[model samples]
Target: MQVKQVETETEQKQAYHVRNTVFVEEQKVPAELEIDELEKEAIHFVGYEDEIPVAASRLRFVDPYGKLERICVLKEYRGRSFGSQIIKAMEAAIREHGFQKSKLNAQTHAEDFYQSLGYQTVSGEFMDAGIPHVTMVKEL
Candidate 1:
C-alpha cells in the first residue's frame, strides 16, 4: 500500500471516488456536501493498495494552521490502518507548508480513532452534514 499527495487531475478523480464511495454511498452524506467549494484550493492525497485507489484526504491552509478534511477509506480497505496513513501523509504536507498545527472535524464515532493519532478534542459535539462531529487538533 502507498499514499501520495495528488498532483494531477487523474489523481484528484481517484481521491474523489474514494470519498464518494465512503462518504456518499456508505455513510449517506449528501453528494453535494461531500464535495465542496474548498476543493479547488485544497491539497488532495490518495492511497492505493495493489494499484487500486482505496483511501483519500485533503488539506487546506487556513492561515495559522491547516485544515484536514474529507478523510475516508474504501469500505473494503478499513481496518488496515490506511486511514492513519492518509492522516500522516496530510500532516507531512501540513508541515511542509510551514503550518504548526492541523485540525479536523471528526465524526463522533471516530473521535477515538483520531485521538489515537495524537489529536485532542477541542470543541463540543456539533452537527456537520447532519452527522455528530467534534473538532480535533494536533500539533504538527
Candidate 2:
C-alpha cells in the first residue's frame, strides 16, 4: 500500500470515496458537515492498497500549525495501519510546507491512537458532529 498527496480531480474523488464510506456512511455523520467548505484550501491525501483507495486525510495550514482533518479509513481497512500511514504522510506534508506543529480534533474513542502517534491531548472533551472529541497537538 502507498499514500499519495492528491494532485488531480480523480485522486481527489478517490479520497472523498474513502472518507464518505467511513464518516458519512458508517459513522452516520452528516454529509454536509463531513464535506465542508475548507476542502478547497486543504491538501488532501489518499492511501491506496492494490490500486484501490482505502484511506484518506487532509491538512490545512492554519496559523501557527498544520491542522489535520477528515482522516478516515474504509471499515475493512481498519486495524491494518492504514490510519497511521495516512497520518504520517500528512505529517510529512506538513513539514514539507515548513510547519513546526500539527493539530487535530480526535474522537475521544481514538485519543489513545493519536497519543501513540505522538499527539498529546490539549483540551477537554467536546462534542463534534454529536460525537465526543478532544483537541490534540504534536510538535513536528
Per lDDT, the best of the predicted structures is 2
lDDT of each: 0.93, 0.94
Ten-residue stretch with the least lDDT total in model 1: 57-66
lDDT of 2: 0.94
Worst 10 residues of 2 by lDDT: 69-78
Residue by residue across 46-93, what tens digits does model 1's lDDT show? 999999999999899886879999999998889999999999988988
- The list of candidate 1 runs beyond 4 A from truth reads none
The regions of model 2 sitting more than 4 angstroms off are none
Candidate 1 local Cα displacement, residue 10, angstroms: 1.3
- For candidate 2, the per-residue lDDT at 114 reads 99
